[model samples]
Structure formats: structure tokens, C-alpha cells
Target chain A: MRIVASALVLSIPILTAAEAARGETLTVTLSHHQVRITSTYTGAELAVFGVIGRDGATAPRSGDYDLVVTARGPRANTVLREKRPFGPVWLNDAQVKFYDLPVTMAVLSSRPLDEIADVDLRRRYAVGLDTTRASNIAPPGAAVREEEFREALIRLKTQSNLYVQDERGVSFIAENVFRATVPLPATAPPGAYEVEAALFRGGVRLAVTQTSFEVTKTGLEQFLAREARERGLLYGAAASALALVFGWLATVVFRRD
Target chain B: MEFYLPIAEMPVHVGLVLAMSAAVGFISGMFGIGGGFLMTPLLIFIGIPPAVAVASVAPQIAAASTTGVLAHWRRRALDLRLGLVLLAGGVVGTLLGVLFFNAMRRVGRLEPIITLSYAALLGTIGGFMLVESVRAVLRARNGAVVDPRRRPRPRWFGLPFRMRFPQSKVHMSVIPPLAVAAAVGFVGAVLGIGGGFLVVPALIYLFRIPTAVVVGTSLFQILFTAIAATLFHAATNHSVDLILAMLLMFGGVFGAQFGAQAGKSLKGDSFRLLLALILLATAARFVLDMVVEPREPFSIMLSEVLP
Candidate 1:
């Protein structure tokens, strides 16, 4: 009886040890301004068996798992807090080499998704958020800009590594990498704003992320108008007068012929 | 100074708008026709709201149309009786057309209707012109007068209000001209055009009006229709884009003059063929738009904000 009891006691530790060795592990650190993760427990992994899936499937291959990730909220001790799973990837096995691993934890930034661009057709085509403005946004008595926004977008596209388009001047923006800082104008309408965010990995979509910001009318609209009017009113008026004079001159000059 | 369009974060430059305005102006100049056909489509393509495009084209059309009328007058092309008859019908048509336009808005079907109509109109005009031109060229090659002059039956002679056209040497019912003018006016209201294209062709083909008389009467009716359109857009939609219109008009008047001069050099067949090509191209673009699914989630639904 004593022998059997001792055997049972011995079996307890061995069975318990096997069950406890589930390989749930997470490690994080930084190298060369990039975060590196070493992991065994892949409960947070983005893919499985070369297919887009959850980490619950199987442990990822031991390598540098380059993934599309973002961090928002706050900073952590030498790392970002709330390190959650993020991906629809930018780099994969092809680009990011396995830096040395049995490691699986992906090191990522706390930097939130940043909008690279926004465009306005000027206030001429819009009224305080009217729906018809959805199709055409021309405000009353506003100087119609002939092709100004398109030209500006074309130029901006050339200068910055960005793509530009508009949904009837409702929204104009470019989609880029995860960690980025977008340029905003001084006259930006202020409100709790949501930006459309999409993530691409190796030219394929990985995930779409959204970020919010407080966009407020920074009083720049009024200032811009004052300036635009001061600049344009005179110029338009002058050009018109000149056209009449030129028309008269052309008539007179061609009279002899 | 900076300008902000609603969806964009940054303000746009006035200079850029001017460049676009110039492009519209160049088109107006290239074609003696009001560039409204180009303007409205181009505006929508570039992302101006539909209402805005319709509203803004008004002032610009007004200015450009005036210049055209003046130029045609100088050429001694104005036909008083024909122009007056067409104008009478055009005014009534424009008023009625506005009601239809509003009703379409109430039903939220304006854009689709307009786009489809535009494409259809342009496609028919272009196709007709191409066939007619080819036939004319073939007849010339065969050394034959293409149309054997069998006296066309006097379809309009017996109708009420027969009117004399000194220039055309025909006396026809005013009914046909009036009906044509009214229909064109309706198109103008819906499409934000002066309806000169619609008017000119019908006068030639349906009524057997001379090309010169057609041109004169078309312009005369266009003037009144454009004036009505301007007032309607302003009072109802309040969509008049004054600055934008002014900027575009600045280039439009001069461009129209140049286009008129250029049109002068082309033979009748050549002019018709070119017009046909333009119309066909415009029609194809609209067809493509309708057939191809939009990338965005929402399709526009139109409704009248005013009765």
C-alpha cells in the first residue's frame, strides 16, 4: 500500500510538469531603434501555417515575424503599454529576416496611425455640412475654383510619397504605413474626428485601423478668406477690366485689316 | 490665403482654381458652343457637388452666351422672326422644365437621369453626324448630289401660325419651332446648358431651316433660357458660384470668339463631324461611369430642398 501511495505521489509531479509546460511565453526588447519580440506562446500571433489566422492554431516558425503594428494610448517602460496583436503586414518573411529566434513576440511602436494628408477644395463649394454638398460643395457667392484642387493634389502627389483622391471634397487623404505623422493645416475644422485607416502588408491588406482626433475650426478659415479675398478680389477685378480694354484694342487694331 | 474644403485638412490655393477655370475656358474657346457640357461633367468628375456645378455654370454661360450673340450679330447672322418665335417657346419650356428638374430632385433621381440623358444625347448626335458625313463624302466621290431633290412634303405649311423666314425663303408653322425651343429649354434646365446644340440641329433637320437661321434662332432662344436658368438656380438653390463663374467667364468670352473664328474656317461637314466626335466621346464617358461600379460605398440620391 505504501509503495502504491509513493508511486501515485511521484506520478503527480510528472503529470503536473507535463501539463504546465504549455510553452506560453512572451519576451520583448529593443534593438537598433526597432522593437524585437521573443516568444513561445503565440496566443497573439496573426497567422498560422502560411494562412491568415489567429495565433491559437500553432506556434509560428522560429524567426523574425515582421508584422504591421500600431500603438496608441500611452507609453510603457522602454516599451509601449497595451501591447496587443496588430497586423495586416507591411513586411513579411521575404523582407524581415529571422533575427535569431525561438522568439515569437513582435516588438512594435506605440505610435498611432497618422493621416498623411487631407485636402479642402476651399470653402467655396461647401455649406455647413449640407448633404447636397456631398455631390457638389459650392457655397453661395463663393468664387468657383476651376481646377485648383486637382492641380494641387497632382502637385502634392509628386512631392510627397502619397496618393491623393477625393470623395466630392468630403474627404481627401492618402493611405500609408503604420507609423506615420500626417500634415494638417492651420484652418482644420476642429471636432472629434475619425480618420480612415487601412493597413497593407507586402501589398496585401492586413488590417484596417482607425484613429480619432479633435479637429476644430482654428479660426484660420476666416483669416484665409480675408486673405484670399484681399488677394483675389483685386486680381479678378483687374483682369476683367484689362480684358475689356484688350477687346477694344483688338477691335481697333484689326479694323484696318 | 488658405482654403478648406470640408473633407480635406488643408486649404487649397486660389491659383490652382484659376488654372482649372482656364481649362474650362479653353474648351469653350475650342468649341463655339458653351462649354457647359464640358464644365458640368468636368466639375463632377473633379469632385465639385452637382448642385454647385449646375449653379456655377450659369454665370459663366451668361457671359459667354452674350459674347457669342454679339459676335454673331456683327456677322449679320441674327434672324429676327425666327429667333423671336423660338424665344417665345423657350421661355415657357424653361419654366416647365424647372418644375421637372425639381421633381426629379424630389424623387432623388436627378444625377442618374441627367447622366444617362447626356450620354444618350451625345451618342446619338455623334453617330448621326458620322454617318451623314460619311454619306456626304461618298456622294461627292461618286460625283452625285447626295440628296436627290424630291420636294420634301410641306409638313409644317398647313399648321397654325405660318411664319415667313426671309433668310430661309420658307413659310412654316411657328408650332414646330416653338415646340423645338421648349424641348431644348427643358434640357437646358435639367442639364445646366443653354440647349443651343439641341436647338440648332432640330431646326436644320426637322424644320429644314437654313443653317444660318438655325444658328441665329438657337442663340436667341439660348439667351432667354440661360437668363431663366441663372435666376432659377440663384433664387431656388442659391447655387450661383459668382467668383468661380467670373473667373471662368474671364477666359470664356475670349475663348468663344476664337472658337467662332476657328469654326468659320471649317467646312460645314467638317464642323458637324467634329461636333459629332466630341458628343460621342462625352457620351462614352458617361456610359462608362454608369456601367462601372463606384469605389465608394454610397451612390448619390437627389432630392429637392425647395418646392
Candidate 2:
């Protein structure tokens, strides 16, 4: 009986030690939960702050930690077209449709994505814009190369300030803590956005923490958008009437004596 | 002077936009046409998206046409009977135009198609107008009374459905006027213009309507066509930016007042010559854009996913 009791005590410490090495814990805080788009809305900056610790401990060692932060807008289907010379004129030669792609994406990492993760890992996690390919569907019998279209899509998105990648965008302020600031351009579509902070150790994912926020129109913009989507006929009628009235008023005001 | 455009979701310099609209409006007022051809391209160049630029300019065309119509009404220059027939054809053309526009948009080919068509159409029309106006100016300088009515008639003038337009004192087949107006309306809807520039010339040269009646009749038809265009854009594409339209109309109306006063100072031949030159210049720019290789050869557009 005594031997059995000693065995139980020995196994308890071993189990606790195993649990300690199981995974890291992550917590995230954002500057704002909702972005209000008003008349003067040009663009906005969001500061994402997070901390990583192992098994509920206060802080993890600096050398053992690597962080990657990504912020992505709502997923939507997108079509990318490539223009090529057809005879003497330029025409749309090829197109690729990407399903469930983020309209805007920003990736920030402690180091370059290739340096931090292997090809499979990067592809799985979509660590960089180049590595991200979410179900690109091409037309049947299209002779165009898929890789060329995908690269062109990324290039176009980057030029529009929609897809961004910064090798050193994330910085460690102290051991186990990191922060990043993402800039959303004026052209960013209004929708829900997800911000993810992933903790890694030696090229392996430890833990991932996620938070979400919303971007929405307000005031006159909100009313106009609702009218357009919901009561389209009424909106059209009103717009036409307003135009007519303005035209008549202008004529009357500027009429010669 | 920056003002936020709620619908466009961007901030623009109030002074710059107002001045630009005013300048275009002045030209429209002097020409007695909707300035949409100039307005849409200029708006796009100033960073407005092509869809939004095309849709938003419809209301401005409506407003400018209304002003022109009122002025012509005061002068008793409109042929109401002829205007009605042109508008009847315009309605059908606009409906078809909107459908074609949406189909092109579905294939993500709207921008390039619009640009290419603009280049071709503007080049042809501007070239013809330049030659005609230059000849008119030279004839006036030589003190020769060149009567437009004495010009050789087109072969198609003898087609069926002959009708009498008493106001302009002409008897011709109705098909030519209707077909011409329909063609102009189609281009107008696609390009976000009032079709006034095209319609005015067709009335004067093709249908041989008097110059005095042509401007008023063109304005009358454009007012209705623009109204249809505004409704179609709003209901179908939801792309009509009311804030942008209102700002442009505000400047356009005021500028038309000054343009009318300025028109009084210039001779008819000189005025036509100046307009022709401007048209040629605008068309040249479009041609240059088409022939030149773009820096970026790829474009991104939103795709409609099956629900």
C-alpha cells in the first residue's frame, strides 16, 4: 500500500510537467472594436498589442518566442484580369476568380515569413501575401498559367494598398510582449475584419489568438447606402426628382432679365 | 477647401471640383449640349472610379439639359413634335445600353471596353466636326454665303415612314431621325453623356433641321434621356453618387449663365471652330491612352459569387 501511494505522487509531478510544455497562451488587445466611417473618413490606424506566455506563466523567454500578426478584412470573391496585346489593340486575355479572399490584408512578422516557417507551414497559415492562395478557380479550358495570374493579382492588390506585407512590422517591446500597427486605406471596403496574433516557437505554431472588429458607414453615408440597397426604386425616383428640381431652380435663378 | 464627399467616400478640394464643373458647364451651355463626355473622363482622371463616375454624371446631365431646355423654351426654339419622336427611340436605346453595360461589368471588362469605345467614338466624331468647322470658317472668311441646306442629301433620306416636321419646315422619313437619336442615346447611356453633341449635329446635318430648332430639340430629348439614365444607374448598379452629382450641378448651373453671355460675343463660325478644336484635342488624348502601353497590365475587380 505504501509503494502504491509513492507511485501516485511520482506520477502527479510528471503529469504537471507534461502539461507545462503542452502549449503557449496568448492574449490580445486592440485599439478599437469598431471603426466608424464618416464623411471625413480617409483612413485609420489600428494598434494591436499582445502578450505570449507559456502555460499561464507571466512571460516567455525572448529567445524562444516569435510572433506573426495578421489583420484581414471580410472575405469576398474577386476577379483579376490580365490585359495583353491582341493584334493591334490591348484586350482582356485571361481572368482568374479567387473565392473567399480577403479584400484587404496586412501581415506583420518578427522576421521574414520564409525564415520563420517552411513552405508547407507558410502555405497552411498564409503567412505572407505570396504564400496565400485561397481556392483560385479558373475558367474551363483556359490555357493561361495559374501562377502567372496569381502573381499578377498580388501585384495589383499591393499597388492598390489593399494587400500589405512587412518583414519586420511586428516588434517585441519586452519579453513575451509584441505590438503592430496596421493602416487601413481610404478605399477599404466597409465590413467585418479579423485580427490574428499567432505565437510560434522554432518554426512550429504554439498558439493562435483572434479578435474581430467592424467597419461601418455612419450619418448620411449610412442612410444613402441603406436606401440604395433596400429601397432601390424609391431611391431612384427621389434622385431623379431632386435632379429635375435642381435643374429647374438653376434655370430660374440664372434667367436673364 | 477640402470637402468630404459622402457617397464617393473620399475628400476632394471643393474649389477644384467646383471650378472644373463650372468650366465644363460653360462649354455645355455655349454648345447647348450635356457636358457628360467631358465630365466623365475628367472625373475618372481625378480619381473617381469609372462606375461611379459614369453613374454620377447622369444627374448633372439632367440638370444641364433642363437649364438649356428652359432657355430654348423662352426663345420658342423647340420642335416639340420632333423631340417626342427622338425621345421615344432614346428610351429603348437607354434600356439596351444599361443591359450591355451590366453584362460587360459581369465579365470584369467594363473599364477597358468603356475606354476603347470612347477612343473610337470620339476620334470619328471629333475628326468629322473639325473638318466641317474649318471649312465653314474659311468660307466665312472668304465672304461666301455657304448655305447648309444646299448640301447634298444622304441616300437614306428617302426611306419609309415619311413625316413632316412643321416647326423646322422639313419633310423627311421618320426612320432616320429615330435611328440617329437611338444610336446617340445608346452611346450616351454607355458613356454617361446626354448625347447632345451627337444629336445636335445629326439634327442639323442628317435630318436637315434648322440650327435654331436643333439645340432646343436636342436639349428636350436629353432631359428625358438623362432622367432615364439616372434612374437606371441608381436602380440597377446602385452607383449614382448623389453628393458628387449635386456639387457638379451647382457649378454647372452657375457657369451656364456666364457661358450664355460669352456665346453672344463670338461669331457662329468661330464658335464652331473652337468647339471642333477642343473635341479633337480630347479625342487625341483618348487615342494616345489606347495606343500607349499601360504601366500596369493587370486589373482587379469585385466578383459576384453565387449565394
Candidate 3:
């Protein structure tokens, strides 16, 4: 009761002054305990980092701050609020910092690897008409580039919701490397969705950020299907048969013996 | 590799290793072969390094073999005097084998050697033992039995170190048995097998030890060979990985015990023939691999599977 009374008396004088506030710096990171990769090193990931602290000029540790961080978009919003329960992360005596982390806050997809290219069909679909002029401007074999936007057209055709990074009190290390990905499941909603980055400290909301990306899923399946027409169905059947035999033998000897 | 884990990993479960050891124990006991013959390869196929698998198998081999020997001893099947002679040779041979193993590692060719050895050795031995046992089985079916009441042969009367073996009922020199023991030890060293297979053959064909005692006596010597191998690997090369090895051994011991019990009901020659056939088949596969140029040399061929 005495400690509460003293804090109340101290805050009363400060509350009346109503001074403007600033920002606070807190370091954030993640620590992964163990990681394993498949025999085929196709999948990889980026680590996410989150830091949380308060501005001494205005809001203290217990005070709320109207933090705004320019991130990809809002889906990162969910990750931004409240410190979670005990995880792989380690905390010091102060409980205000995170250390030597593992995965960063981004995941980049890998491409379809091919050992042999019998026919050059990696390029199949062209978005938009190239406005017709660019196709004429190029050499006979080359398809000219179109400066006109194709995303708006895609948006009308499919419900496109691109994820953008925007949040309060979250700074993201932007990964600008564009990736060529083939969708695995067609059920995946093709639209623009917000990619949010969040920060939580000591079980409290501290910061967040968001980003946006357009979902492009067309002609992806054709890449796998292209040149098989020349090989015919017999080879595919034989290959599938061999694969089944191999898989069976592998399971026989290799299953948790 | 620097050995890892026992008390290190979280949620420490020695129970898993212990249970596995028991299984390995059972199988090895039943088969009358140090399951290490199978353990190392099986572990590696599952991604455990060969060194760790071998190291772990040693301890479990000792444990399970002890149990097997105890049971056999109770049945008066084991010959302690024979085991002692074999141990002396085995300890020496194990040291040499560990040395060679290290040297092979330095050359980066242990895989080929190991692969070739397992495929060739087991397949050949299994095949030969199977054929021989089949013949004996056929003869027994025909009711052609050797007279058991005949006086003991004194063929080794002229040989040195002549001594009486009341169980064997022979007044013969100890030199042949010692030589056989030493030769088996040498092979066991190079192959990383417990030498039980070789010992059984020696007892049957050369030393004329009774077929009934072959399993028990070979197992007796195997315990010693395993101990020596474990110590040698531990002391000299530090090749024995206690953690991984123990994990494999744990499973192996239990498997061996159950195998031993199962083996108990089988006829002598039939059991021998089956064991030999397994050896031959596995060995033949190894040899075939060496001779048959696989379509893809770089294929992901698993040597063992995960437990």
C-alpha cells in the first residue's frame, strides 16, 4: 500500500506536466536449439528477430507507446503483441533482452531444380499482351517486355491480397530478393496478404511491422508437365514402377530396424 | 568423432538405450553371434556414424554375452579353459584391428572396406555353413548315426602340450586349439566380427570340439573378444562411441536374448545351417555389389535403417 501511494504521488506531479514522449531501444533476437536439413537441400528458412523497449522521454517500461514501424504488412500483426511463454530463447537477469539467435524473420522459397533440359520450356506464359508493340520491337524469337501493369489485371481475375509490412515499433531487415516459386497446393488463396513482423517483451506488446506481396499462381504446373509429351507415357510408367520398387525395398530394410 | 551425450541431451532417457540393449542382448544370444556383426551396419544405415555404432555395441555385447554365457554355463555347454586361450589371442588381435581401422580412416576408404567385407564375409560363411549343415541333416534323416561309444581318438598323441580334456575325452596337445583361437582372433580383428562364427567352425572341423558345445563355447570366447575389442577401441583409437554404441547395443542385447531363446528350440544342424545361410546370403550380396557395377554409383544407398 505504501509503495503504491508513493508511486501515485510521484506520477500525479508528472501527469500534470504532460510532456511529449520519444522512443526506446531494445535488442531482439532468436535462438534455435537444433536444426536439420533433408538429404536433398531444397528447403531453407530465415530467422525472425524482435526487439522491445520503451522511451524514457515519455513512456517508461510500464507505459504504452504508439509505436509505428514500416513493415511488409499486417499479417505480421499477430506476432507483434505480448511476450509468449518459455521458448528456446534465453533471458538475462534484467529480462529485457534476447541474444545470439537462429532464424531471421523471413523465408525464401527454392526453385524447381532440373538436371536435364531436353526442351527449353522454362518460359511459357507471358503476362499481358506486351501491349503488342514490344513483341514487334524484339528480334524474331525474343518476346518484348511490357511496361504496363499486370498485377491490377490479376487482381480482377483472382482475389489478390498482397502482404505489406507496416507496424508500430518494429524495424524489419528487408529481404528484397525476388523468388520464382511453384505452388504445391492449388487451394492456396491467390491474393495479396499482409506479412507482419512483431515484437513482444516480458509478456507484453512492444512493437510490430507489416509488408505486402501479390500471389501469382499460373502456369506453375505446366513447368513439370512440359517435355513429358515427347518422352511418352511408357517411360513415365516404367519410372514410376521402378520408384515403387525402390521405395518398397527402402522401407523393408530401412524402417526403424 | 568426439563422443556426445549420455547426461547431456535434455529429457535424459537412459531407458531407451537400456531397452534397446536388452533387445540386442536377446537377438545376439539366440543367434550365437555377437550382434555387433549386425549392429554397426544397422546403426550406420540409420545415420549413426560407424565409430559410434561400434563403440556402443561393445558394452552391450559384453552385457548380453554375459547373460548368454551365464545361461549356457548353467547348462554345462561352455568350456572356460577354451575361452581363456581365445581371449589371450583376441585381445592382441583386437588391438591390431583397431590400429588398422584408424589407418583405413586416414586413407578415407573405410566405407568400401567395410562394405566389401560385410557383403563378402557373411555371405560366404552363411552359404558354406548352410550347405554343410544341410548335408548333415540329410544324413540324420537317413538314420545314419556315428557310434558314440567308440574310444576317444588319440590322434594328437604325438603332438606337444599333451593334456587330458575330460569333457572332450581327448588326450591331445593344446597347440591346435590355441592356434585355431589365435587365427579366429586375427580374422575377428580385421572384420570387426566377434569371431564366434570362425570359432564355431574351428571347434567343429579342426579341433573336433563337439557340435553341441560349439555354440556355447564360441559365445564364451565372443564375450572375451568383445570386451577386448571394446577396450582396445576405447583405449587406443577411442573408436568406441559409448552413446551411439550403447543405443545400438541396448536394442541388440534384447534382440539377442529373444533370439537365443528362440534358437533354444531349434535343432543343432538346422540352427547352424540357418545362421550360415544368413551369413552367406549377406556376404553374397556384398560380393555382388563389388562385381556388379551399379547403375548409379552416387545413388543414396542406405547401409542400415533407423531404429
Candidate 4:
């Protein structure tokens, strides 16, 4: 309560004391812009900080505000396969291909998304898991029963903690200041991650802001991954040579026998 | 401790990898072969991508065979001429194997084909070895002469381009050894194995090579073929994980030394019987996996499908 009172007092800049709230905007920042994945990287938690700014003389809102934070990783093509029993063995029978699906995604909101906004608004804004699924773009001539495959994909990703949703992941520390926490798993690929913060009041979106961060490999992890991808023949030969050395070293150690 | 594999892009427990490889190494050492056939399947079971598992095991197989190859070289127990001839054909076969592997992977049927192949090949070999070893055991129990080395040569032994293998004390067409090694090498590359088991039997029974040089010659060929396969997989598939291979090699080499010591006490017929049973058990496991319905019938192929 003290923090909210202080925030209100601080916003009274006096220049437009009688003006109605107008040109409301969100100022967003992140705890870290560069996430480095090293050999010991298990996971990381990122913090999103934002402030709701409006005209200096804007009147106080009539109701509490809502915030939703969404983070999405780099996109890639994905395939979902279904197996069926054939003769005495299970075989891959059906498959669906989704183009440019985010490798990792999470939706965090101050309250249940449905309470904050209606279904059409949430779907239009792609604010939650269901909306995210709806946003997926499948190739033309995709398999029938694609909803089953899409649901399965989301389920599997959720099981692996790749796709996440939390109803109470964001909280307003001050009346106009909010913070959201995004947890990143070790399996998160290295790429640009987009973070979107949206502000709402009375089920109406007031302001939206966007920011991005990068996940990158560092040190030995980066070096090895680069070599394997760019210098395949050399890396392979080196691996074979290393194995031979280990074998020879073993023989020498056991030669006395 | 856990370490991340760059190529496979996953984390694996170091202790688990070492323990699994050591156990497979022990079995391979006791049987005088590279243990890739066992290690590759075990790797996939532990959640490593099948393509990465198959490619990385190639280096491990080469390393395991190096021990036998060097020992045989030092003792002058292997036929260099025959080994080179087999290796020449093995190179051609390895190339074809890599091509086939890439084609199957693109079609997304690589895992099923690999599983089916292992089941059929292991089952047949195990069945044959079981009957032969059981007969040998019974003959020894009855105090009968156990030697069964004398056998008639095949009709194709007289094919053109004959070569005299002075060390093996046999004169046969080079075509036979070349063809046999090519087939074994093809299977070895595709399955990420050393093919020592296949080669040793072919040399002894099909080519009528003396048992004295069979193991050494087989190891010589396997070492080169595995190296070739490793190179091909690394260059073409880009799936070989050097870190994973190194971890496997460290555990396998150390375990092999201890296994060789333990093997000295077992009788030859008992050893053969034990190996046959192990092979049969492995084959049965693959068959069971294929026939049983998976709890989750839907699986995601975590690869670039469009790009």
C-alpha cells in the first residue's frame, strides 16, 4: 500500500494536472539481454520489469490493472508422427508438419487469462497456450485430424517443460510498476527470444510493449558446437584419432600383464 | 556429474555413460570383439538420438579393436596380406553403407530398419552358435573327440584371381575374402558395429582360414572399417559426438583389460555357450520392443523436417 501510494504521488508531475489519462505507454526492460549457455548451464530465470506511463495529469484508473507476459524462442520446422500397428509391429503411419514453430514458449499472467480478457481478444493477441496453438501455421495439404497432432505436440512439449503456462507469474510491486519471471530450461536453443508485456484494465488492453534477448553458447560449448557444424570432416577425423589414442594408451598401461 | 553433448544437443550423466560402456566393454573383451553392437542400442535406450548414437559408436568400435589389432601385430599372429585384401573391400562397402544410412534417415524409417536388422541378424547367429556350442559341450562330456575343424571347402574356392595367403597356409580366390569382408563391412557400418563376430566366423568356416589367424585378421579389418564409417558419418550426417565417444572409449578400454583377465578362467565351450545366450537375449529384447504397443504411440521426430 505504501509503495502504491508513493507511485501515485511520484506520477503527479503538475504540468498537465487537469488533463485526462492519454497516450498511455509501457516502458519495458529485462534483467539480462544475453543469456549464455555454458558447460554447467542447467537452466536460467529471467526477470521482466515494466512501468505503466501516461500523461502527467491523468486521473487514477477505476479498477485494478492486469498484465500478461509472454516469451517465445526462435522458430523452427517441426514434425509430429503417429504410429499404428502394422502386421506385428508398430510403424509410423501419419505425420503433420508445422512450419516455423517456436522452439520454446511460455505465457505468464497476473491472473487467469480468461478473467483478464475475453476469448476473442486473447486469441487475437495470441496471449495463451490455446492462442499460441491456434497461431501455428501448418503447411498446405497437411494431414487431416491436425488438431490431434497439434494437441499432442503441445502436450509433449509441456511434458518436457518446453511450453509453459503460469496463471500468477507476474505481480505489480507498485501501482504502475510490475515484474515477471521467465524460467528457461537447459534445452532452450540458442537464438533470439521475444518477450511481450501487455497491460490491461477492465478486460481492455491499454498498452503493449515488446523486447528481445539472445540465448548464446559460450566457451567450450560454443567452440565444439561450431566445429561440429562447420568443420565436419576434421571434427570426425579428430574424434577417431582421439579414440585411437585412448585405445593405445590403454594397451600401454596394461602391457605389463 | 553431467556433461552436454554438442552434436546431440543434450545432457547425459557421466557416471551412467561410463557404467554402461564398461559393462558392454567387458562382454566384448571376453568375446574378443568390439562391443559396438551392444553399446549402440544401449545408447539409444538412454535417450541419445539414434543418429548420434549410431555415428558416435563408430569411433568407440575403432578404439576397442585397436587393442586386439596391436597385440596381434606384435605377436605376428595375423595375416597382413589377407587383412589388406579384406580392408580393400571393406572401404567400398563402408561408402555404400553411409549412402544407404543417409537415404533411410531422410525417409524417417532408419530406426525401424535398424531394429529389424538387429533382431534378424542376432537371432540367426545366436541360434546357430547355440546349437554348435551345445553339441561341442555334449561331445566333451561323453569323452568324444571334440575337434571339428576338418570340413570340405566350398565349390567357389576355385574362382579366378586366386591368391596364396602364405601366413594362413591356404590358396583361394581373392574374390571370396573380398566378397565376405564387403558384406560384413556393409552391415557393420549401417549398424555401428565392428563386424568382428561376422568376419571371424566367415574367415574360419567359409574361407577355411586357420583359427590361429582368424581373430587377428578380423580385428585388423574391423579397425579400418570402423574408422572409415566414423569418417563418413561425421562428414555426411554431422551427428557424431566426440565428447560422448571419448567418454565411452575411456570406460570401454579400462573395462576390457579387466574382462580379458576374467575370461582366462572360463572353458572354451562354456564361453561360446554364454555368448550365444547373450546374443539370443539381445535379439529377444528387440523383438519384444517391436511387438509390444508403446504407451505413447505418437512420437516427435526432433529434427528439421522442412529445412
- Candidate numbers sorted by DockQ from highest down: 4, 2, 1, 3
Among incorrect, acceptable, medium and high, the docking class of model 3 is incorrect
Q: Candidate 2's residue-wise lDDT over B17-53, tens digit each?
A: 7888889878876776778878888888787778788
Candidate 2 residue runs with Cα over 4 Å from true position:
A1-23, A55-60, A140-144, B1-13, B92-125, B150-175, B186-194, B210-212, B278-286, B304-307
What DockQ score does model 3 reach against the true complex? 0.02
Model 4 regions more than 4 Å off: A1-24, A54-63, A133-142, B75-77, B97-118, B151-171, B189-194, B204-213, B261-266, B305-307
Q: What is the descending TM-score order?
A: 4, 2, 1, 3
Residue B231, candidate 3: C-alpha displacement in angstroms = 3.0
lDDT of each: 0.45, 0.76, 0.44, 0.77
Taking the candidates in order, what DockQ does each have? 0.04, 0.35, 0.02, 0.49
The candidate that wins on lDDT is: 4
Q: Model 1, range B61-161, lDDT digits (tens) per residue?
A: 55555555555566666677888888888888878887988888787635665767777877897799778867766776788664311348466666987
- In model 2, the number of clashes is 0
Residue A130 lDDT in model 1?
A: 13
Kindly report which residue stretches of model 1 are placed more than 4 angstroms away from their true locations once superposed: A1-110, A113-182, A185-257, B1-32, B107-118, B141-154, B297-307
State residue A206's C-alpha deviation in candidate 3, in Å: 25
Candidate 4 residue-wise lDDT at A250: 81
Better of 1 and 2 by lDDT: 2
- Predict model 3's lDDT versus the native: 0.44
Residues B244-278, candidate 4, lDDT per residue (tens digit)?
98989888877765565555566666666777788
